[model samples]
Target: MQDRTLIFVLLLGLLVCGAVSLTVGSPLPAADLLLAAMGEGDPRHRLILLEIRLPRVLLAVLVGWALGLGGAALQALLRNPLAEPGLIGVSASAGLGAVIALYFGLAGVWALAPAASSLTGAGLATALLLTLTRRGDTLSVILSGIALSSLAVALTSLAMALAPNPYALSEMVLWLMGSLKDRSLHDAATAAPLIACGSLLILTAPRGLRALTLGEDTATTLGIRLPALYLRVVGGTAAMIGGAVTVAGSIGFVGLLVPHLLRPLTGHDPARLLLPSALGGALLVCAADLAVRLLPTPQELMVGVITALIGAPFFLLLLLRRHLREALP
Candidate 1:
């Protein structure tokens, strides 16, 4: 009951933040009644607020939710604090898949090309990592993911170099950097269902995650099927990550930061961590999205750049702290 209350409060706060972000820019009057007087403002302003800005806000929420949930699940499964899409190369692999589809003009012909290719790349990377980790230790899996990520990035670079049209290459580079500019309803619609499905599976399987935290032998004693649970979490995270990259072009660090940031609030219980992390992630991304818009610049900053700026130092700090803690005792 208390957790439910917390989740509701967090969600409400996120929504309020999103609402404020929505109203901050443009020619629309800030008054509720005035803004409610639809069809009264410049059509472009109205469309910008309603169609462009709203969808981007919503996308930030959904992407954050998926990334947070997936991160928590992966961390629980691997029994590591630093595990995330960025560390494991899932985002890079997904990017490679999306680039392949785009370079071949598959994305231009079929709206689903980017997503399908991303899923394929993610699944393949997951498979390769699993296969390479014969003993299935955390270290082995992490190393495999790193190797796969390097390979994927190399391939993506090759594709960019070979792109037939410079314009297409330019657009791909911009997209890879990540932004919310000119997003539309269709972009949200494509990724939402995939994220929703994956989230449902993770939320429903929290008991298994809790069992996992005590390690494999203990979880097996508790009647948890280790292989099945691993598949569900890993595969579900792949779906979530792949879908997100397909739409947003590899926005980084939300998955890496949200779970750790909210763990204290959830008492460090993975079962409790997942949902709160989702809400926290939504809040972070929406706030960041608002910042990008509010910043005075000739060109709007990439969302990924902002998140990396904040997250990279934090990541290094975490590693240093961990090293110090280990060295102490």
Candidate 2:
């Protein structure tokens, strides 16, 4: 498909999925829910529509966009289809930060404390990643990221193990599982600025990423400032992924899944993949969240669980395809 056409379809999908998400959890008909969202329905319905579901929809869109855009940027930077936000430990570190905040009761004291700590953790992880990896070495970068991610996950587990009470441990575990349920507009507002800033930074690098595809030497000769590109991509990804982990608590695979699915439609142009991937991510998350609500299971699945179920198999397919290609030649 043409890039513009693909993007348009993704946008339409996002709109439809977002509408479905808003209407699914309520007893009211879709039309009535729409009216309630617009403040024209019963007071109780209005509260459910405006206060409860709207924020969740909005958060899903924002988180999806951030993850998708971040993933595209990271993949372009690493020049690897498998590259994702968590590959560099940003998400894991952010999760650790939030876990610490919850375990220490800082989250109880201030709603935004966990988010603040998450951002701090992401920044630290990025710094450590850069410090540990040699400049312009993709293998080193990935390895360092894996190391940092492992360390962060270990620390998070330690925090949970030492939780002061069962309630605290349960909260930590549930948050780590990831869900959009019960999120408020305040949570959306808290995450928006960081996600926006990170997106801008990521979007700025498309030309550079395209140029880098020809090789670093060629890109450097074309006057692309590699250092500046690295900084923008890393900083932007950190901000976006950190904000997402803060609000959604480690929702997995949206970043990885969206880009891989959309890249072919974008003609494999890393720069062109950004917007469509963002839209696709929003659509996927909205659809998945809606499914969780609409399904007849005894309990609604966490959004992350839904994504993991989809992504793990997709990941295996990619691996198998790579192996087949290698065997063919």
Candidate 3:
């Protein structure tokens, strides 16, 4: 898998999946769909394409891109094979904030309240993570993140336990499950800037991360400032994760799944893995969302649920393979 070929395939998949996404629930013909997409067909069909499907597709891509890039950055930064977006507390904290918004009826006052609250939580977690691990090594950073994640989960459970009503509890639980459904272009726009900025920060990581493969001491001798590198990677990851959670709730596995799948293609180069992972994430989410829409269930299946179903098994298999390999040697 040459990088060029891999990129081309990913891009083509994204385009095909995106087009398929817009037509998943449509009864219209392909020709009519094209007309509607171009603003020259039935108004109702056009509305569905523009207002309903378009936004959903955009959000799926954006969230996937953020998750994949952030995940790769975190894995490279920590030099850990198991690293994912949730390892940093962003998922739990963002989830807790969204739960708070819905649990207390804050969402009633403003439609975007949940998104705002989620971002705030992510920011706070990032701040706290940096503060706790400021002068510490990667181990300290990982431990601090785990601590924050634990606290956030505990608080979220408490909130659910004391919910004013079962309905409130249900709502909180659903949002935390993560989905790209019912999103709007506004949501995509809201998430784009943070994701873009964070991606920019992480894209600069290849040289440093490559050097880091030689150990931190060797990296330092090679002129890599470990502290600055850590800050850039962690801060960028937080921002991207925050942006993703703002719209998609707590979708997981894109970050965890994409990079590892592409590692062989990149020959284990952490830097080379980022772009492919991001593209692969987008393709997975788009295809998954399309699959969810096509399912025969009475209600549309949630994208988050589908990914979890896929990712959990893959994760277990990955662990088994890793342990087996170690045992073999």
Best by TM-score: 3
lDDT to native, each model: 0.80, 0.85, 0.88
Q: Which residue segments of model 3 deviate by more than 4 Å?
A: 319-329
Flag clash pairs in model 3: none
| Alpha-carbon RMSD of each model | 3.4, 2.2, 1.6
Number of backbone clashes in candidate 1: 0
Compose the digit string of candidate 3's lDDT tens values, residues 111-163. 99989999999999988987776763689779989999999999999999999
Model 3 whole-model lDDT (C-alpha atoms): 0.88
User: Which candidate order results from sorting by TM-score in descending order?
Assistant: 3, 2, 1
Which prediction has the highest lDDT against the true structure?
Answer: 3
Model 1 residue runs over 4 Å out of place are 31-46, 105-116, 123-144, 315-329
Model 2 misplacement above 4 A: 127-140, 318-329
Model 1 residue 277 CA deviation (Å) reads 0.6
